[model samples]
Target: MIKLQKNVDCVLFSVPPILLLGPHLAPALLKAYAEDKGFRVVCYDPSPGIYSRLNSKEQEGWPYNNFEEVFKDKALLLEEVNLWLDEVFKYNPKIIGLSTHAWASKFFIEPISNEIRRRAPGVQIITGGPVALDLGIEWKQNGWVDHYVVGDGEEAFLELLSGGTNHPNIDGKIPVPISQEAFRALPEPDFSDSDVEYYKQKAKGNRLYLIGSRGCVFNCSFCNVPAMTQKYRYKDGVEFAREIMNAQERYNTNYIELADSITNAAPNEFRKMCHELIRLKEEKQLDPKIICFFRIRRAQITQEEDFALAAKAGICRLKIGVESGSFDVREHIGKKETNDDIFFSLEMCKKYGIKVNLLLIAGYINETEEMFQENLEFLREIKRRELDEAIEMVVVNELYISRRTPVFDFAKDTGVFDNIDPEDDLARDAWQTQLSNGEMLDPKIRRQRVHSLKKFVSENFVHLKNLLVFAADEKFSAETGS
Candidate 1:
């Protein structure tokens, strides 16, 4: 393996927010830096307690289901950070790169930043990722962080490491485009130095991490993808397939996670990649579990052939961003999906026997009780159609509205977001509260929205129970078939 620069060893630290998820983008950045710039990379994850609990749960036959469960373990969170600090001190890296993501940003970065600064005052502290972008201004104002990188960090990070320029001004503005060629040329992420088996064992055969594409084409108001990655770009399919095959071979594992913003944004390109995977499987070149994010637009998956191709490629799980059930809200959020489109797309996934995870954002600028009820009704309709068994519903409360997104503009125009604070604690708390309450325009309507949402969830508890049972049965069926 290639080593990094002699004088300035680089340590890549992923301060994952107590979440027992799969591999993150930090390792990929490490590999990119090492290959492209020859930086000696050491990866430290300060979340071992979380990993331990995850392993225990996996052994007990109940794997972690969501990011919340993994992050809520406070004890694990502390222990992991301590362990990570020890490892970092051993390396004594000249530069420390903190891998930031959206969910973990709220709780993880500040403490990690404080610890790093306290322990190693001389080391240059750099932060990157969507979370970094969202909170770059805040970090800049604080003295802990030396530099904050927005957008893709591969090229800019290397430039910084080479002493090409002083860290860019952290004005809380998004950075310009980094060349896609840099990402393509980046070496496969270096997880070999870390305890790969530990993470795999924790996964219990239900985890993988990947990145075939970066960014999204659509400008969804509430989403950060557009702001983070201004353009959509993809690695060549053959290259992606090789990466997957390599990871599977190295880890002795098959579960593959596509960490792309949208895996199937370009239909023809995606189909071609799927066909390549099928070919690889046929030639015994690869055998891997696959999960990917796909837009639920009917136009993307209109033909039966496309669905068949996707299945043949081993895409077993599809995460669709079905943001809302109401047409107006969908349009308002720039999703452009009608109710009919959602139903048709869902039915197609069911027909293909692919597990579907529906992602819903609860609150927006002008969300109404009627809109929330429409979503509940849609869920009921899905349950009635017996598609609930194939679908897992994930509703997330919004936080940290990006200043660049359409939602920010909407908030400003509608007077909902009068207080703009990149750092105020109370403002952040209010934002979370508004998100939980569905951001009802009128105070009276807020309760109704919450009540309707609660009612829908309560009414569908049996359906959810049955869906879980069905999922277990399906897993058994697949294992038996294998």
Candidate 2:
């Protein structure tokens, strides 16, 4: 493990308004990667510290989801950014890497990067993560960033630090996904540089985040995974299991959250990992439980035996993206799971005593009243089958039109986004969508459905909880003054 350095070669940062439970994983991974190559690297997550500085009244208005709120007033934003910069410049790192993965962090990148550039003229500013993968070219063209490392940042960043450039995955030229064999050989993320105790205190419990894989097996229309990652790749089962065990030993936490898009995307590897975890638990007398996002597939592929092994392996919870309850909507969105498949998945979870969290979208592009009713009925059936006991929560959100998604292209092709500028990258949240029946679905209808679903779930199920969240809600409220 690399200890904190007073004067480091690189200082990695995670921008503010990332009000998540655990610490960001990117900086820790980057720190480990950079230090392995003999570069002195220190990681900083000043988001919590920066957010705590705001007054109670100011905090109330600045919704946690909207990063733009922090940037609305340049003077106030600069004051906050400068306070953070003061801490970073103390290290006097030659290279500064900003983790621009979260979409909300996008708004902070410009203000934060500009300040870094102004304050430390000699420091090279590099940006990476999901945001960089999508809009690296724009950020580069704007001249705020010296370089951008898209896709996987570990190797690309190390190369940049070694004075190498013109690589396909660096300098905003293009992103090349790192191969699976390469991913398997990477070192464990060094959390020693992070305020681990602070994150543990803030989190629901003592928890750590890890990813066994990169990319998703299924390319859902509404998801940006395919474009972002290019291909599915996972660490070997034995290696990943050991990584989990090692993380638990170091972090002193049995609660692990898998950051992979889908935990069981590679069924064979997943089973192998579970088997290894089960073996390790028995041999070492260690009990480490995992919570991961899962994809429901055919029974033969994602069998009940898989869930059984997962339970024995100490997987306590599963967050499944059951995007819509309507079959047609699911199919259209590239999720091939039938109602039967969903029920079977839920049944297996129930059988294994694993808590389930269902993710739902309220207003898909073509979701009609009939389709929505089917969604409601799906919930009713869960209650009927007593699957609600296994379901801990259902999170519902309004459909977002993110750039580079298949849904976004479809919206552009249709008349829904006719009035919007083709070059407008900021207009990601659209309220209006033309239904299959030639009816326009507006924001009001979507909000109603979102609320309606929540109400139904709350009223009907005893154990099943529902949370309605959307990043666009704050922006819409500010615009309409509702």
Candidate 3:
């Protein structure tokens, strides 16, 4: 018999296929927002719980193993879902909200949603996040979910809790961006209901997540961020800094991962935040180390002093989305970083002793063999110049062709893709796609290129670790070891 928590209005779930390292940002953010609005909400993130039960082999394969593999094991998935359902019902809330990603929607979310419906017939079900925004209509049509919040959930979620429907961005209506004021007013995410200790131990530090902004300024071809978040908005510098301070003080963690599309998209706000962080370090004796995605802009706009300030403010690592090394290829993907810009950014980070992770894409719609060789030569140059010293990790991936991105439109317009069923949920393999230059940048070609790049990086730059090679097409190869 389950003993229900008194007066719980809503029970939130951070659905699986999420990283088990720390508390997920959406549930914690929504939990904070809802509770601040005087609703009694309890968030149940079962990722840590799920991770604890996995064997050593499964544990080692995590995140890279992904939701697809996990969901395939129906027995294991159901066993975990039943256990979670037992715990969830203990809260006996009037409504349930789930947060999921696009990748997890078809795999993890579908089955669990069905189970939830079967067990609790009367409780209203709501879902929001990237998955909800992308597939809300499909999920609703299938009767898997009652309500799905599309773009921003802060206001829509509140409206849903009050039994409001037919709102914009709700139930498959057009997306509505949250106001900057509302985004700013959002309180520090509450993570009290999570398995904080389990996450801390799993992460091997008190690492946590923080969000200072939403969306990206750049309209990269392969990215869906601009479409998803609607527009870029950020908190004030002092307010952002204070939120970090408050979270650190409450959670007893100095390490934070910024869940932003690009942390310095608003350079003025970024600078001010850095200054405030420096002040907090001095005045409050708080040393908060941060890891975030950063845009490698030109020197004129992004000065060297900015890196200096960032280092002082405890920005330990920056993940730069240098999707391609070739100038033309990068330009095609809407990344305008020149070789000089890349070198300057890397050299500056090296000067500041800040670690960087370079994110590269293997094969885009227009990548030719020559373009690939250009990419390889660029890597060779990095190794030759010992710029690899500044790099913590180099993440190489096969191009993921999502229908929601501009890249998909490019593929369709150019007659590059094979017959793709309109009903398929996840990003399909564009391996059959042929470039205008009569080059079939197929799976075998992409795999071989990725292997060659990995072999060079592994052999030459031993100190620089290579992160996940997201090859959605094939199994782990002996060369890359995934």
lDDT of each: 0.64, 0.80, 0.80
Q: Which residue pairs in candidate 1 have backbone atoms (N, alpha carbon, C) closer than 3 angstroms, thus clashing?
A: 4-39, 4-40, 18-70, 254-289
| Candidate 2 wrong stretches, greater than 4 Å | 1-4, 55-74, 422-428, 474-482
Roughly what TM-score does model 3 have, to 2 decimal places? 0.94
For model 2, residues 232-294, the per-residue Cα lDDT tens digits are 989998889989988877776648999999989888889899999998888878899899998
Give Cα distance to truth, residue 430, candidate 3, Å. Answer: 3.8
Query: Which clashing pairs does model 3 show?
Result: none
Stretches off by above 4 angstroms in model 1 are 1-8, 49-82, 103-119, 166-172, 396-402, 419-451, 454-482
TM-score winner between 1 and 2, please give it: 2
For residues 358-396, could you state the per-residue lDDT of candidate 1 as single tens digits? 666555455666667787788888878877666644433
| RMSD (Cα, Å) of model 1 | 6.5
lDDT of 3 at 118: 89
Candidate 2: deviation at residue 166, Å? 1.5
lDDT of 2: 0.80
**Model 3 lDDT tens row, 94-188:** 88888886455456667778888889888888888887766778888888789888888888888988889867878855578888888988988
